[model samples]
Target: RPSRPASRRDDALYRKADFPWYGLDAAYTGPRWLMQAAVAGDGAVEHGSLGHGEEPSVRTEGGADKER
Candidate 1:
């Protein structure tokens, strides 16, 4: 296996680019920031959601997402 990325930004970038493939077998749409909200400062927080397949439909709990 390749060596891990050495920097936080690089790792985050790597994950951002690579995360989608993590779902290739699960019929999932993401490891994406499914919900994000601004915090009090210049910072923000996000929550990610992964979808497992349920034939004929794609759904997310909390009604947070719908397929386009």
Candidate 2:
């Protein structure tokens, strides 16, 4: 079967990015931050939300959750 075309709603903005940290402080941290901001459910800290000013809550490795 042929693949269906993606709609505007299926854009990258609607996708999620994963961040894998190997160590406490790594060079890839920069990229991880970028990816998180790009597709993070809570949205970017600078942008303060993509469509809404309210951002979602994000869980941290410290067993705590924070809002973006």
Candidate 3:
């Protein structure tokens, strides 16, 4: 079966930001991806996170949920 052509919008997972993005460190170089970017009111990135290496996994802590 023929598949539909991929569009630029479909391929775009991350939004454009004015700030520079970096990995964990200079020594560690691996697969990198844009996680998220925090944009200020003036349209400037305050801080953001860039994912590298393996994707993180979710793990519950504090021995399950407890009413506080």
* Model 3 segments more than 4 A misplaced: 1-23, 55-68
Least well predicted 10-residue stretch by lDDT in candidate 3: 1-10
Best by lDDT: 3
Tell me how far the alpha carbon of residue 32 in candidate 3 is from the true structure, in angstroms, after superposition. 1.7
RMSD of each: 11.0, 13.9, 8.4
Give the alpha carbon lDDT tens digit for every residue of 1-68 in model 3: 00123244322323445445555565555656555556678865676665565666864565679989
Task: Residues 1-68, candidate 1: write the lDDT tens digits.
Answer: 01322355434433453234233454444333222222334332222333233322444566656678
Q: What stretches of model 2 exceed 4 Å from their correct place?
A: 1-3, 13-16, 19-41, 44-68
Could you estimate the TM-score for every candidate?
0.22, 0.18, 0.44
Over 1-68, each residue of candidate 2 has an lDDT whose tens digit, in order, gives: 00123244433332432333223243322222212223335652322122222233664566556778
- List the candidate numbers ranked by lDDT, top first: 3, 1, 2
Question: What is the lDDT of every predicted structure here?
Answer: 0.34, 0.31, 0.50
How many collisions per candidate? 0, 0, 0
Report the lDDT of model 1 for residue 66.
69
Error of 1 at 57 (Å): 52
Question: How would you order the candidates by TM-score, starting with the best?
Answer: 3, 1, 2
Best by the TM-score measure: 3
